[model samples]
Target: MKTAVEKAADTDYRELSVSPHLITEAKSALMHFERLCGRYQQMYNTQVQANKLFVVKAKNARMYISHFVQVLYMSIQRTEIKEEHLSLYGLEECNMIVPDISTNEQLLEWGRKIIEGENIRISRGAVPIYNPSIAKVKVMYTLFKEGYQTQKLHQKATTRVQDEVAAYREKVDKLILDIWEEVEKDNMDLATDQRLDRNRQYGVIYYYRKGERV
Candidate 1:
């Protein structure tokens, strides 16, 4: 609808006896709409895709953490470390008692503490667990963090674009309506079909009922 209005204002306004100012207004509105739509689409896509990646990364991190805990139990059993040593691996109990790291925020805090505790323990002459070790868990957590931050950024961008689009929507609608009315009034002397054809050349929109002939 706005596209037709823009072209009408540019090339058909003089013929349709419409004001030239409508052309500039339509162009500005159309340009802003185009930019807003493009930006909004980009932000929405980034948010969606980033969130999906974050979910996968988060799941991967959770799986690795579970594996690390299993290995920690076995590894500690073979060592001289006591139950008190469980705290060094970010666990309070030695019997598979893990925190409820479900939400992304919880997972973030859990993973960070686990990595830090493991690092501290390893530095204190503790052997690093093999296979699904803290290093691997850290990698997964880092990926999850990256995806989470990206999704957050684009979510805000999408919201800002939505607000701008909302604020400008009525203005664009009014401009298009004004241009349509002026063009139709100028071409009113012609037959309905002829006037419709003329109006279309000036960017007029027509809506036909469903199942009705065009």
Candidate 2:
């Protein structure tokens, strides 16, 4: 997202450094377009900041769940449950390590199992596994679930903003094209390559194929 806005900014900045005569002919108008793109880039930043908040919160939640599962698995040694049913306590196949690719949904599911299994065990006179009780762990999972939903909403909103940025880019590109076209028209008598070279002085970029040059 930042890249898209920054690219448009770069183009506008370069084009603003145009040939001297264009000061009266086009430079002021060019500044207007530059400011238009700048305004949209600022708008895009608001969405960027909002999306970052959700991303950071989601990461924190994932980290907590991963840690909680790992700690619970290690504490399973103090439990009376047999190895075959260890997954009921959220230990994956009785292993103490959480998978590297575990997602928020998967982590939340593990949290559910940990609380339920722990509660059942507590009912039967089983000692609590770790220092943070299952009740407290349940609280963490509940908060984590809430954050997951918030993260989803933010992601969707950010996607919509990204589409708007795309539209803004197109609008800016058209403005640039109009300016470049007028500049070319003003130099219509010059040879094509010569005229293009003149436009380059106004920061009008031209693309070349691989291994090609001016």
Candidate 3:
């Protein structure tokens, strides 16, 4: 009733003899490749030359992954179980396959979320949005968590600094007023002493120095 290819398509790769580690590595590589593609779209010509080697590596890794998947799929097809047969599928074709969030729909959603997300600043020249990593959601989650905490700490520090500056300015103003009062009092005393000396010279009065009369 069903062709071999169709039956193969329905097989569950999880039930097969595939190595979970290799599958995890393949998924990570695919996500990394997609992220690179997003970055490549925004790169300048200068970066193209500098990133040539990375590009080559991504391409080779992609090819290796494709080849490995095919081999693994074929090897797994050799043995069949009574319940569910295991088969390999592309990154997006099956439930367990990682989704390429680099797609237009996913990217648009990410951009909207970033616009609404707290403490996220988009520079005029900065990349519009972060590209989503597929299988490496754990990595993205860690980075975003760290970034959010760091931003909150920075805001708290800035607020404290502002309060300290305001208090310092008030203290400085009070000190200045006190110094001015002292200076004015000293000047008035000196002027009164000069006037008394003139008056005494004209025989108008007697005067006393701070402790002893003269």
Candidate 4:
């Protein structure tokens, strides 16, 4: 006959119906997802930082040119300069010119287009590898499900194991309580005899025939 403790231990040992192949496939799927998230996040941060730095440098360049133009205009005004007098500033001929792109908005828009182009190139390069990785994850999931059977069956088996464990624990506890109660009763009977002997040793004795004093 199996002891209560042995039965309890057996109840705790549950055989998983899931196959090792399914576990390996599931892990591969998780790893793929992790890599995809990490790679995309890294690329996104790099592109954003690059774009911001490009915009900042362009703005600084524009500011420096604007300051130089303003100083030149003020000096020309103070000297009572005419259009032809611009030759001193390295110009053979003087003519008023209007620029096609002369605003901060236009500069920012051009920077955005460059950033977009770079992102497109990166995405195009990744497409061949990215699409296949996604398909592999899908295939792995299908195989994992086939190996493990249905989700409902897995859940029912798990619940059954849990119930067995609970019942085994209950039986183990009752067995322990019964053993303890028997030991405690024997200890109580021994304790009464011990108390009487201890009293006699301390010189307080009781006798039925006559009074014995110590």
Best by lDDT: 1
TM-score each candidate: 0.71, 0.53, 0.27, 0.28
Clashing pairs for model 3 are 12-86, 13-87
Model 2 has an lDDT value of 0.60
**47-111, model 4: which lDDT tens digit per residue?**
55655654555455444333433443444567533434333333223243211225545433332
> How do the candidates rank by TM-score, highest first?
1, 2, 4, 3
Candidate 4 similarity to native, TM-score? 0.28
Tens-digit lDDT string for candidate 2 (1-214):
2222333345554553333343343444445555665656665666567656656655655666566666666665656444544555656564566754266677667667777877877787867655466666676677667767766665666566656666666755665566567556666687978877766665566888999875
lDDT of candidate 1? 0.78
- Single out the weakest 10-residue window by summed lDDT for candidate 3: 80-89
In terms of TM-score, which candidate is strongest? 1
lDDT of 1 by residue, 1-214 (tens): 5656555546644464466777767778888888988888888887887787778888998888777776777766777455677887568753666677788887888788888988988898887777987888899889888877877788888999999888888888898788889888888899979988888877785889999884
- Comparing 2 with 3 on TM-score, the higher-scoring candidate is 2
Minimum summed lDDT over a 10-residue window in model 4 is located at 126-135
Q: Which structure is stronger by lDDT: 2 or 3?
A: 2
Query: Over the stretch 1-214, how does candidate 3's per-residue lDDT look in tens digits?
Result: 0121122234465532223343344344435444554444434333445345444433433333334334333433554211122221222233333233333344333323323321122232322222232223333333444444444455565555555555555544443344334334333444667745533332234446888854
